[model samples]
Target: MNFSLQQPLENESVKLVPLKNNDFDALYQVASDKDIWMQHPNKDRWKKEVFQLFFEGAIQSKGAFKIIDKSSNEIVGCTRFYDYQESDKSILIGYTFYATKHWGTGLNPSVKKLMMDYIFQFVNRILLHVGAGNLRSQIAVGRLGATKIAEESVAYYGEASKLNFIYEIKKEDYLSVS
Candidate 1:
């Protein structure tokens, strides 16, 4: 239970830091853009109220982070690991969003690598839930070598939505890849 919780994970390609107060302006700028949240479960489309609510939740949960570009020192996106069920020895990694520019590049792979590497240090398994309709995310999860386990309608943002696929990777499997 004494897990070392820290922020701002950095590697050669990207930096994953806690979403702090200073990130408000930058996060709000990108999060407020309608195009960013189009495929997201939260249909609010990053509106002011939605962003506020999201940030508040993130702060309270203490499980999210802002993705920063080390070279340019710019905020490129956000990702997090939440809903930790210690009794089940499982945790969920979602609420990820990256700027259009960061998409398609190896940035995501590198970020995920860092997160998974860190997470497996203490947990036995990790779960990723992707919207079924989001092919991009689905493929990403598959590329991570996670096996799809099930699908269900879960409440996200504010409503009960269907087509959420749950993918899981055990510690042994993760070690094989890492």
Candidate 2:
């Protein structure tokens, strides 16, 4: 079977549903808080117009998910699985952001865990691109046993290229850790 990037994924705390055009408002509600994007590469994403472009790209990618808080049944953030390479059995997990209210509550790791656990079954290596200036994301990926492999300019969809740190987690290593 072909790997399905937008498959519905869930755990006890959160559920990840394929993002749709209708999800724009609910997602923007959480994304509108300036603090959520303060440390992100695209700091102006809090603005409606800027975020609209981001949302459009997410829909186009067809791999993006609107994260929901299971308890409150509210949209909490967004993430995606992109740049999958079948020959190399590798894929990228990124473009992730969350509401400030969810930060430091162990939600990031929980979300990552769900994504990693699901995707690793199809790919041997999972890659992440963290903005060079985004220290918070760097540390978070590290805690997942991912090591920075290199740094390069990454042009986010509908955004200018920015320096990013490439991190990689091999399937063997991840399995060993878990």
Candidate 3:
């Protein structure tokens, strides 16, 4: 079976729509906040020049999504599914960021559950790369039952490599948790 990464996904709280070339401004508006990328590997992503490269990569990836708040109908963040390895039956989900307002509102897990529910139908495991210093993301992934299995220097699209912790969630593990 072919795996499609950009399929639209949503729950009662948020929606994931295929990101378009025209979405640069809207997504950038949410990402412009300095705090948003403070702990991210590419801390300069808040800059237009850097973010343009990131957005270009997302567009080329063909698996990026713009996250929208259902109630406000506003673009709150962006995420993507990338590096799908058929041999390993695994995929990586990262490049996720949300507005500060949604930080502790259970939206992350909901969005993750939505993605996992859909992708688990095609793959056996989902891997995530969290910035080494990003304690918030580390905690969040842990809460979703993902385990830190390794550390490596990961290269961001059109950016320098940075130390990152790899987290894994097997289909069975996610099923048991959710």
Alpha carbon lDDT of residue 160, candidate 1?
A: 57
For candidate 1, what is the TM-score?
A: 0.90
Model 2, position 16: C-alpha lDDT score: 96
**Higher-scoring candidate on lDDT, 1 or 2:** 2
Error of 3 at 33 (Å): 0.3
Mind giving the per-residue lDDT tens digits that candidate 3 earns over 66-94? 99999999999998999999999999999
For every candidate structure, what is the RMSD over all alpha carbons to the true structure, in angstroms? Answer: 1.8, 0.9, 0.8
Clashes of each: 1, 0, 0
Where does model 2 exceed 4 Å of error?
Answer: none
